[model samples]
Target: MAGRGEMPMRPARPGPPMQYRGPPPMARARVEPIDREKTCPLLLRVFTKVGGHHQNEEFAVRGKEPKDEVQIYTWKDATLRELTDLVKEVALAARKRNARLSFAFVYPDKHGRFVVKEVGSTFSYGHGRGDDAKSLAELGFQIGDYLSVAIY
Candidate 1:
């Protein structure tokens, strides 16, 4: 109440209005749906090659693999367009029609080495949509993993 100055008003800085949390919403792990006639079919073990992939130092030896093996019993919900149509029935160069497979996942790491790991790519006919619907337990595939395809 001074008669010649008027300078007194400072009290308004108390909490609530600074939000920007950012980083807590990535749960996603609800995969359950495999009962292909009571399940029981996992022997993937594929290894074809024609133009690329096949060099994690050639799986760094363990019985010298990479002679174009193909032994799929499949069913981890198998998809990559159903393993690219079971590797075009047996890889007649992936059945042409502008072939392009390219999928990997050799596995072994933890000092055992032999880690290919690609995980997706498809097209031997078309209309299969993205990584051909990805499966084999959604591409984390681990059961002696070893798929390696790559048939441009």
Candidate 2:
């Protein structure tokens, strides 16, 4: 028996040296450097609240996790009317059949308080009322804003 305190004797000859069968494994993918000058488009987190007939079904499937209920979307070069349309489209796609959908754009004021504004169903051809005429960039919204959707 070999003891831990002493080295054990072995055969004087060593087995054949192991040889690699193929070329060296491929190198790992290189990480691309980020461009600091480039900035991301204004993005908003949306939380959908299910209601009416499909409310039970949606809740059953999605549970109550906020991450499962939230969606992130980018709105760039979009007017208020266009943004409303996009939000409506998303709501329609996500809601149950025959469900009515509404949008609320949630933003913060200069005092760091949140303000929610309801989006109208109809869209005007030209520039809209108030901040509707301005592009997203003109609205002074940075990335990571939020918009909540209500399904009825």
Candidate 3:
């Protein structure tokens, strides 16, 4: 202790030097491209009637009626015509079966409302000679997109 008018001194405590750990270490996740090949083929659902009854091939029907088989198609960047032909090939009864399939490519309009457009004539769905053809990719179609197939 010091007397009046005198100053008392205290020992300084030492601490570890401060360390700067700039922006917590950053980590990156590895990303890989999708391998379209060697995976389960892409399948599109088509609706058709059997025996005068409206049926959905993807969904099984009740009450003893034969279940319309679901058609499977390979994934490809194809035109509407090619998709239609593929459906025809898978659906053997499309030509003779009681169900008449009116193929339509459906997509949401700018308003987000689904619009089903008919694709029958060569001019339909932007398919024609030369560069008029439109591929699914150009149409902005992505995986899991649904194409409505109307049957009468």
Candidate 4:
């Protein structure tokens, strides 16, 4: 019974309006560290179709190449059965890449010479231990350890 220029519809602005207050739902997703040599675009055409050389071969030049490098030592000299045969060649190349391996342990700095080691900034695939995989040190293989593997 209250018509005549009715302006009576303003009783609905109490509990949850004005865009629900503010700030309470942003727990994860702010990562920004991508600079793989300016974002690996085919990484120089897959290193020129794999003919770039230097695959181990004892650091190439005459080692027979193709392996890139693989000579880490430690873990208590790996119970010396010839360095425990490099854990059956790093577990048979991690079971042929079905995935399963992530190692990080190569120490040598402060001018003792020997270096190389850096991985894990978030690159997905599988197998990752401690920090990831990167290896060197042993400037000439005295056994400070190693693990320069890239077997995918």
lDDT of 1 at 32: 86
Return the lDDT, model 3, position 20.
92
Model 2 RMSD, rounded to 1 decimal: 18.5
Model 3 spans with C-alpha error above 4 angstroms:
1-40, 48-69, 90-132
Model 1: lDDT to the true structure: 0.84
Across 73-152, the per-residue lDDT of candidate 3 in tens digits comes to: 65535555665455556555544434354544444557665455554322223335322344555555556444554444
Q: After superposition, how far is residue 141 of candidate 3 from its true place, in Å?
A: 1.5
TM-score against truth, every candidate:
0.30, 0.38, 0.36, 0.22
Model 1 lDDT, residue 46, Cα:
90
Best by TM-score: 2
lDDT string, candidate 2, 88-129, tens digits:
555554334444445555555576656555553223222344
What residue runs in model 4 are displaced by over 4 Å at the alpha carbon? 1-31, 35-92, 96-99, 105-108, 115-152
List, residue by residue over 1-152, the lDDT tens digit for candidate 4: 45899876666767855666588886643334444455532200001001122232332232342343444423221212322234335445434434323223233457654343422221123334323332222112233234343323
Error of 3 at 85 (Å): 1.8
- Candidate ranking under TM-score, highest first, comes to 2, 3, 1, 4
Tally clashes: model 3.
0
Q: Choose the strongest candidate by lDDT.
A: 1
- In TM-score terms, candidate 1 sits at 0.30
Local distance difference test, per candidate? Answer: 0.84, 0.49, 0.48, 0.32
